[model samples]
Target: RFNQFFSFFSRIDTLGLNNFIDPRGYVQIQQIMENMTINRLEIRVDSLYMDLQIQILGLCRKNNIRNVVITVNPGGMIDQFRNKLCTESEFGVTLDVCERIGNVEGAYFGQWRRFWNEMDVYLRKKGIKMQMNLCNDNGFDHDGYARCGVRSHIRCERMDRQNMGVIRPISLSRGFLPK
Candidate 1:
């Protein structure tokens, strides 16, 4: 059964799987790389499980895996486990993990923001770039209105003053909106 699943994945370069999948299932996938190569592996987990994540990491190491993407939901548990795995594994596998924290009313958004910022700096230090997406009703403007080139100087100054020394001055009007 596992082999069949692996066979199916063998034909594709990208594979997405849930976090609670059996470790043996991943191992079987690793075994079937006879003629195929997987460039990217994405795993979405409810929370990070050290043992299971380590098993996946081991497979990646053995298979000469190049890129890995892991996504874990809210709470610090998954982030903690991910840090542990990175620390424990000596094998160099470039990993780009994204952890999305749920937006709950009155939640500690400041803390999570700081945590993600620190994580980014840490990864940058290690020559790895980690992308974090924090979504909240107020924070995320999916319509790109806030990011548009119509920013007023008053608003920019207000934001600068509010952010103090944290927010850097840039050409926000030109580059804020994504094409």
Candidate 2:
């Protein structure tokens, strides 16, 4: 039934599907990618397993998928698992996957700071320019923020704007404030 529907919707650029198989049947996904002319793929997975994400990412890379959207519930602590899984994969694959996935564009590392650190280093090594937001309430300081820049640091609302008045704005070369 799905194959028939997929065939009928051959001209579509976006595809929406739900995963019911355990570990997410990759062969079926490969088949769909091969058969469809999809440019954007949205998937809803039952589990937030890192391996599953990696598998899907790999497939997307192989097919040159331009955009990927995934929905997962925040249940267990999968940060460490995700980091390890990504670490084991090829950097080219991971970087390409990250670039193709639009949702990861502005993703900061507020919770999993350590994972963000390793990921940042890996990304830099691969020459992948990506931003990470890593300064929420994760109970530990990973120091990854400092590695990025002082401005990249996450501060409380009280601290963020406290010294705003002390800093002077540079005058423009045009003499006027330009506004």
User: Top lDDT: which candidate number?
Assistant: 1
Tens-digit per-residue lDDT, 76-127, candidate 1:
2343533655432234444444434355433222244566557556645654
lDDT of each: 0.45, 0.39
lDDT of 1 at 162: 26
For residues 15-34, could you state the per-residue lDDT of candidate 2 as single tens digits? Answer: 55565334457667667656
**Worst lDDT window (10 residues) for model 2?**
93-102
Query: By TM-score, who's the top model here?
Result: 1
TM-score, per-candidate, Cα-based: 0.52, 0.47
Write out the backbone clash pairs for model 2.
108-132, 108-133, 109-133, 109-134
Cα displacement (angstroms), candidate 2, residue 45, comes to 3.5
